[model samples]
Target: MAETAAQFPEVQGGGSLIVAWQVKGKTVLVVGGGEVAAGRILHCLNADALVTVVSPAARLNPEVAYRVAQGQVAHVDRNFEPSDLDGADMVLVAVDDPAASTAIWQLCKARRIPANIADVPPECDFYFGSVHRDGPLQIMVSTNGKGPRLASMIRKFIAKQLPSDAGRAIETVGQLRVRLRQIAPRPEEGPKRMAWMSKVSEAYPWDEMCGLSEEDIGNLLRFYPSGKVPALDELKAMRANPGADKEAFDGSFGFSVGA
Candidate 1:
């Protein structure tokens, strides 16, 4: 299955590169420096993973190493050790330690821990992909560990489709959604009990939060009748009307429908 997929129809490049990374609170070991290590660190931070970066020498990115010194990250100086995998869930052996990293790779494979060994193809369990972030959303693009440059170029393509302001609006609504569910009368069925919830998305006005207070969400909820919440499709439409070409509607969540 794995061998054929490597050479199969879409897995080569043109397919939807899909993967679910189990990263929340998982321990990640990153070794090495320069741009590669910085990129990996940022990716890990996005996942909220517990990352421990090991490096012998320091670089210009003091904030990178600062996180380690401040105990936000665990750093190991000098060489890579076999026991480094003591409690690691994911390992990234990045650097010029081909021999040492290959040894670490063998150890990870022995323990069934997923690991990526930089520079050595055979020693890797997986590889890093290009990534994009739209506020709370994260998208990763990979070429099955083959083409990094192409992956980056694909990221640019993704950037064009996503609205620059979409993330902020979504995040603002998400926070309100959480709070709204808690105070809602039929809390368990909050989604089904709010008629205007979807329309609210069409005009969330994240930038004009200058005019909103915590009271606005409460007042809005009070106006909603019982057992009449909005559906996701409606909310999506209110965000970017699904009825048409699915572009942002004039009365979309970003603009006040009454405005």
Candidate 2:
């Protein structure tokens, strides 16, 4: 017997837990070759996931074709087979035929596979949100499959507001973390280290850190104690003169003045 919607009291409204999946080097099966499928395939490729597209008369867009020629994507020019989900980590169905999509969804459910049917939220195990990627940062905005267009607009707005030097800053902070561990190896300093890194991430000078050597970094860390962050005034001054000589003052500032 099929259970009615009222029987499931836990899920009365539309809400999905947004999460970032680590799909790198994992196989993702896309069960269509239309524009929607192509878009999903491109997203998977960007995440470094292995992608396979299945469609009987799959129509490839220009971008999809380029990737295909580059050997980044594998295309099985045939109808979707249940066996296709043999080793798939996730599945995306974008076929135009509603009946075919339903069938695929049912099979995926039986197999306990994560699946997303284009424009069909109720049948989806996950929703593909609008994604914006910086160098090492990725931001995703989801409307719970309600307003995709709105989600895309929000993504554009956020991308424009984000700093272009974010990726560089991330790398600098990464190096700083390694050096900090050397300075403060005690387990007690772990929380302090994280707090200090949080401050650095918020107000970092991406440009100044470009030419700094490892030794130069060590000089800056002397002022920051293992369990304390730099004073606000000191941070402010460094933010005011980002291009000043690093050796001019005590090695207490490496952040940007206008970050």
Candidate 3:
């Protein structure tokens, strides 16, 4: 299935490239209170973007309403105005009325602001794809606005296959990299650092290191070349001990393996 997706890129619709945006401390204008608008608000909030929702609808999603109460979001209880796009970094128009959506789209265009209109792909500057997040790790799957279900399925499948402690392990590896750079004997040690990183990539016991503190990680790195990082095969053998329980270990790491 993966090979087929790679061989037939034309089947996926084109027009936009998938890229992650850095939205922290930015402002986002959302022009509706419907479910779609609420979903967008959640995504923006997760990215640490300051969101302002302009809508006259009776109510919005409970999560959004709660945020408004907590001062994490600003809710303007009225219809959207052109001026709502005044200082917006981006816009989302998710009103049910087509005419309203079109109007908002035009306003966004006039202001040269990137916008997305739910239910109208042609008006979208970008499409939100399926995502799976684990701690600091996030994986996004997209079909270029062609097949949302396919993207969702791929996201779920990959979510299950990821190691429960993968996020923590990646952070630990990052710290190791920083340490290596600081202590490199020569400035031309790029290749040597790369080789060490490659070797340790599959050699660490991810599950065991899930609860390791910063000090523990630092100590481990100090003995890197002294066989501190165990081989994957060796870790597997250790996990096969009679007292070892895979399900319990996975649960401790917050992974839903059975899903």
Candidate 4:
């Protein structure tokens, strides 16, 4: 057999989980019906995926059971067959049977389906990761099929180091995107406006910056190519002075002309 070495980076257990695939809105087939299967489904849904699980094994986690009952999942009560992977976007096999998992792996490969075997890393295309959540913000940690328990432990440590309001800040920024676009400036001016907005956000509390009604927030500032920037023009005029030595002061000074 040919030997190969693959590079799998250490997971931080806090941030920096790299994705092999983005399965959002894609079909995923999970083979097994137990707590492990439930966990796999939970993470899949967290990415906003469409999931289907093979049934007839055992009870699932209560959360997964509830999601199934709520019509958020589809169940196929049966055993593994290559046909089961037909049209599947991805396949996850969490059965305790290593042989079964390996078989599913081969079948998936033959069908060109992306496969993950929870217990058999050699057969998996991707692995489930330890996950950390701070509200809407999630950090996924994967050791590329090693030390999941250690990953969880590391996640706890990293979670403590993160700012509590990170998720809220992300949400606020996401909410601000449309408004920013609607008031778009000239292409070259966009970066300057973004810099100013970022400074304003950092100077103010998240709640205060994000708390205004959408309309009121929209009206707070608008950027345009024809925008009257008297203060900016004044600064530019000052910079035009013969002995200003502008480049020496540009980096350190927060204020700038045409910035």
- Go through the candidates in order and give each one's C-alpha lDDT: 0.66, 0.75, 0.75, 0.66
In candidate 2, what are the lDDT values of residues 1-259, reduced to their tens digit? 3567558766556567788888999999998877898899989989899999887544776766777778898888788989999999889999888998999999999989899999887789888889998677788999876789999999988776655455555676678888889888899988888887777655544544444445546655765685444543354354435446544333433333222
Give each prediction's root-mean-square deviation over alpha carbons. Answer: 8.5, 8.0, 5.9, 11.4
Q: Which is the better candidate, 3 or 4, if ranked by TM-score?
A: 3
TM-score of 4: 0.67
lDDT of 4 by residue, 83-192 (tens): 77877999988888977788888888888898888777678776677889866678877766567898888887777665445575566666666566666746876786
Can you list the residue pairs that collide in candidate 2? 205-256, 239-257
Q: What is the lDDT of residue 40 in candidate 3?
A: 89
> 131-184 in candidate 1: lDDT tens per residue?
888777677888876688999999978776555654655566666677767766
TM-score of candidate 2 on Cα atoms, chains taken together: 0.74
TM-score of each: 0.65, 0.74, 0.74, 0.67
By TM-score, the candidates rank as 2, 3, 4, 1
Q: How far is 23's C-alpha from truth in model 1 (Å)?
A: 3.1
Which residue segments of model 3 deviate by more than 4 Å? 1-16, 182-191, 202-216, 223-259
Q: Which pairs, if any, clash in model 3?
A: none
lDDT score, residue 19, model 2? 85
lDDT score for residue 98 of model 2: 91
- Compose the digit string of candidate 3's lDDT tens values, residues 68-128: 7788889898998887888999998888889989989988888899999998988988899
